[model samples]
Target: MIKRKFFMTFIVFFFLFPLQIAAETIEEPDVSSEAAILMDAKSGQVIYGKNEFVRMNPASITKIATAIYAIENGVLSDQVVVSEQATKVEGTTVYLEPGEIVSLEKLIIGMVVNSGNDAAIAIAEHIDGSLTNFEKNFNVYLQDYIGVSSTHFENPHGLYGENHYTTAYDMARITQHAMENEIFRSIFKIQEYEWDGESWDTTIVNHHRLVLGEFPYDAEITGGKNGFVSQSGFTLVTTATKGDLDLIAVTMKTNLKNEPYAETLSLFDYGFNNFKTEVIPKGSKFTVDNEEFVAEDDLIYTVNIHDKVSNKINPSGVLSIYNGENEQIASFNLKSLSAPVTKNITDENEENWQANGFLGTMELAILGVSAIIVVLVIQKLRKRA
Candidate 1:
């Protein structure tokens, strides 16, 4: 009877413990977005994802790429005169009038903060000469600069069209790239930018609920952009920081009005609570066998906080990191150091040049042997002569 009880207890332990362990692993939030992603802003790693690669209409979020492009390529102090085409653009506007002069800085602020399609058009025309040229160049611009594959832009402002589309994954990557630029990041996350331009005079407030702190959400929301079209549904993108963890979340085609915001919070919670960014400081060193290695730059890797993260220098000098389950997470090339390794070598390791190189010694020994052999042969020839 005791044996039977012991057997039952063992079986229960074997089954229940593994199940509990599995449950303790990362659990994704129940998000209602049609497509979404939560990405590490620093490392460009997607921490949480759903239908991320499928292309959909980006709507006015196209302004993000446009805004950054303008900041990077144009002179902010230069004054731009609005064109008639800019005034007639459909959807949202800053009510820009033809021949009204505004600094490139104010126009960018108005476009991003206000979602003013007119500002986007004026900026595009001013920089690229025409909408056709702007669209053509900006497509190349996004592909080349932002490093996105599934995004294509047909307009400067994200007006819905058959060809104007981007994936949630691509949008997140684009946002990540944009956030790296100080000029773009500054314009993107402003709370309420007061604008007193030539023709348009009003406070350009960010429409994103999270950015404005309109509700009980993250006050850490540095900035965000939102868009809606009958065709595209609610498309939202936001960036937030808590301690060392900075994250980007993109949601698309949600039925509910606040579902995207809810999903954004959930994803941020999942990321910040579960994951951590570990910085392997620049110039950190390791010894692989008898050779030394150094990290070229500060290495940033994000992993689940519960995971046991460790790095190992392989025989080939590549640094590989493993997570809690002993799964490899990331690998980077280590700059080999000419300095000898910490591990000492003995006579047994003499022939193993990899452990402690003796190439110079080998070359000297060869020369000595050849010299002796040559002298010995010369003496033999003299004796024969």
Candidate 2:
């Protein structure tokens, strides 16, 4: 009876242990944003997500793409003569008048820093010659190059068109890709700039409140873009840095402006605290079936701080990373970085065959070609003799 009780107790303990471990996990901060995501900027890994793929109005954050597109496709020094339509644009404006000329760079600054609708229209008109052409082609660029699978834009200024929608994940991805450009990166983070426009000479401040340091600059805010429309609610995409890790936080469809910012900070805090980056240095080795393979280069991935990472080398020399929960995070093919296993060759072709078996399907094709060549060479030698 004592043995039976002990066995039953053991089973109970085993079952309850997993629950206790689950309870001890770090809690994600509760925020009011209807959709949100936290991403690793380099790896494009989603660290945390809620409704990340759901499409919502992106508002002025659309300019992040427009800014990068102009920086890439338009010459900054080119002069643009403002048009009456640009002056008459309804929403935000830098107060442009017809016949006033400005550099493409100045218009980009106005559009990005001040969220000027007029400036955005001016950019679209100047770069692509018409809004319709700009919209059609830029959407293709966003899809084919930036690699956002689920986003659409009908205007450069992000005015509310029923077709203008993007996901939190897609926006984060777009922001990451945009930040890679030197010119676009320079403009996205500016806190304030003095404008000497024809009508407005006042300093137009960056609308990103955290970037302005109004919210304590606690998470090392690098840069960000925010957007709003009655239909889209409050939307924000922010980038922050900590040590070697650069992170992106995107929040959308919040009730108030500050709510998206609040959610963004919470997401950033949670990510920085709970995750640690692990690097498998270049030339690191793992063995499969007594044969050795070397890492092609440094492989970097982020994992939970307390999670145990198991590195598995399959027969094909592909390294698979498994988290503490035994979930496979990713896999990579490792190259034979060392000299042709000189020792293996010394041991005989047996070792070579053993090593080649684990190098994957392509290597098998190579072996077949080598065998055919060897047979052809032997036949030629016979003919000569």
Candidate 3:
């Protein structure tokens, strides 16, 4: 009876312990949406996600591509002539009338800041001469530069079409690329915009809720894009910065349920609370003067991880060794640096040149070819003899 009781207790402990550990493990947030993704914009690490690769309508998030194309190709100061087709695009508008004139910059502000559909069409047509041609260009652009395999665009506004859909991973990648440009980052970060024209008078308010910092989680939203359509549902791709780490969180295909904003806040808290950068030194040697190259010491050279993480009572700190832009040119790892210098062999250093690598290979090939020629010549001489 004692052995049986002990066996039963052991079985119970084994089963119950696994359950407890599983409960304690960090589970993906229960976002109400069918599809969602969260990535670290700085590192492009997807911290948490569900159905991230499943393609679905991106709604107004399509504007991220539109905005990038405009900034790359169009002159912001140039006034664009709004065509009849652009003004007639159904859905959200900054109310641009036909023949209405607005600066390219203002159109971007309206497109991104307000999620204006008409503004998207206007910008697209302006940038590419026509929406149809613009869309083909946009698809090629995504494939070439952005590497989004599952994305296709039918309309500039992302209003609705069977062929118009994008995966969450591709959308995150698009955000990552867009955020790299200073101007694009600035436009998306804005919460409000007042276009600079009388007839096109409108105050554009951003649709991204987290950008306003209303969530109780107290995370700072550095950048984001918001999208919504009847078929696509409410969607938001937001990047929030906590300490030095930046996280990009995306939610889609839901009616704003599961408190996505709150989930984002929780994600930020988890990320900031848990992980940190561990800076390791990049170079094997640092050259101080023309004559002297020294192996790095902790006092003279150090690994500069951007942030250090600690527990609830103690927070992280920045770890930096070098300062000034030019002085810190050695910050990146050796792989990031240019290939090592290759010196040509000369009469002064023929012996040293044969040590290894390209020079050695070239010298060996030359010697082998010369020896073969000499042997052929000797064979010909023997025949003549």
| Cα deviation of 185, candidate 1, in Å | 2.0
In TM-score terms, which candidate is top? 1
**Per-residue alpha-carbon lDDT of model 2 for 1-385, expressed as tens digits?**
9999999999998675664465357798786788899998876778899999999898899999899989989999999988888888778888887988999999999999999999998899999888889999899999998999899999998889899998999999898898888888788889999999787789999999988988875568888888888989888989998887789999888768688877888888888888767788988887777678888778878777756667788777888888766788877898754445345466778777767776866788899999999999999999999
Supply the global lDDT for candidate 3: 0.72
lDDT by residue (tens digit), candidate 3, 246-316? 77777778776436666666666666665443334434443222222322332222211222212111011
Q: What stretches of model 1 exceed 4 Å from their correct place?
A: 1-25, 197-199, 339-385
Error of 1 at 98 (Å): 0.9
Candidate 2 regions off by >4 Å? 1-24, 281-298, 335-385
Q: Give the Å shift of residue 265 in candidate 1.
A: 0.7
lDDT of model 2 at position 385: 100
Higher TM-score: candidate 1 or 3? 1
lDDT of 1 by residue, 266-290 (tens): 9998998888788889999888887
| Model 1, TM vs. native | 0.81
| TM-score of each model, paired residue for residue | 0.81, 0.79, 0.68
Q: What TM-score does candidate 3 get on C-alpha atoms?
A: 0.68
lDDT of 3 at 181: 86
Off by over 4 Å in 3: 1-24, 278-385
